[model samples]
Target: MVEIEYKNARVKLGDPDLVYEPAEDSFLLADAALEDTESGMRILEVGTGSGFVSAVLRANFENVRIIATEINPHAARCAKKNGVEVLRTDLFRGIKPRSPEARFDLILFNPPYLPTSEEEKVPVWLNYAFDGGASGRETLERFFAEVRAYLRPGGRILVLISSITGVEAVQEKMEGLGFDVDIAGRTKVSFEELVVVRGKLS
Candidate 1:
């Protein structure tokens, strides 16, 4: 187990197969979520690997109910340990409380946005956190497709994306989905430009 300090919280993460470490993408997503959410906002974290950001949100905001979903068993356990009310489901599959009151005001995801070849992909359980398929939009496309079902009337999404994933293509996809997309934040690393995209239904 490794204990890492992220933003305003210290989180303990276990095996990588279970939980993703706190990396640049994680921090970027967390910062954007914090900026977008307020006390009354209802939030849902799509892939709460280590539960760090959800914990931070719960700590920083009041009267805001935050729930997280994780597909990996280990990650789910880790999230539970950190006080996240976790749902073990693949994306939004099998989620409970599908009522309107369960609709989220904002959703956050730091999905696996890195482009990877077939050979480069790892095990299913481990790769879901980082393998973004040949174009890096594999998981992203799925998220954008399924997200509309869970969003409240004015609800939106803040997701961490990358230049490597074809930024223009992502934007085009968002437009196709009837969402007005904008860059919430971005940081350029050595080669890839990591971006946090905020999208609302148009």
Candidate 2:
């Protein structure tokens, strides 16, 4: 196990196969978390990975209930270490908003956005954290299909996308789902530009 400090939170990580170590994508999501913190706000973070973003959310919000979901068992343990309630399941599989009387105020996801072919698929679980499948939209397509049920009437979602993931397609799918999509934040590195897209019910 290795301990790394992310933002203002101390996180312990072990076995990369079991969990996806937080990276630039995770930090970008944390930046989005900054704007969503509100007293008693109910938040759900899908793909919690190393639990870094969940930790950041819990630390920054007041009376806000945060729920985390990670498909990886090891990642779920890492999230639990951060002292946040976690559900080990696929994105939004079966989780209730922390506020029972209402739905989620904000839903955050940093999904697998890398386009990978079946030939590149491996037995490693970490691949699930980065492989977005043929068009890099496989996982996201499923996420968008079910996310609306969990969101409040005016709730919002923040998701990360890479230039390689085809941002235009993602925006279109979101728009088709009745969301007004906008880029909330963006950054450029050597190979590609990373974008944080915010979607709200129109």
User: Quick one: best TM-score, which candidate?
Assistant: 2
Q: Residue 123 lDDT in model 2?
A: 81
lDDT of each: 0.84, 0.85
lDDT of 2: 0.85
* 1-202 per-residue lDDT for model 2 (tens digits): 6988865678777587668888788888898777766888888888988888888877666588888898988788888987879999989878753443488888899999999999998887788898999999899999998998888888899999999999999999898899999998888867988899999974
Residue 26 error, candidate 2, Å: 0.7
What lDDT is reached at residue 161 by model 2? 91
Report how far residue 21 has shifted in candidate 1, in Å: 0.4
TM-scores of the candidates are: 0.92, 0.94
The TM-score obtained by model 1 is 0.92
Candidate 1 lDDT over residue span 30-95, tens digit each: 888889898888898988998988987877777898988888888888989888999988888876
**Model 2, residue 131: what's the lDDT?**
92
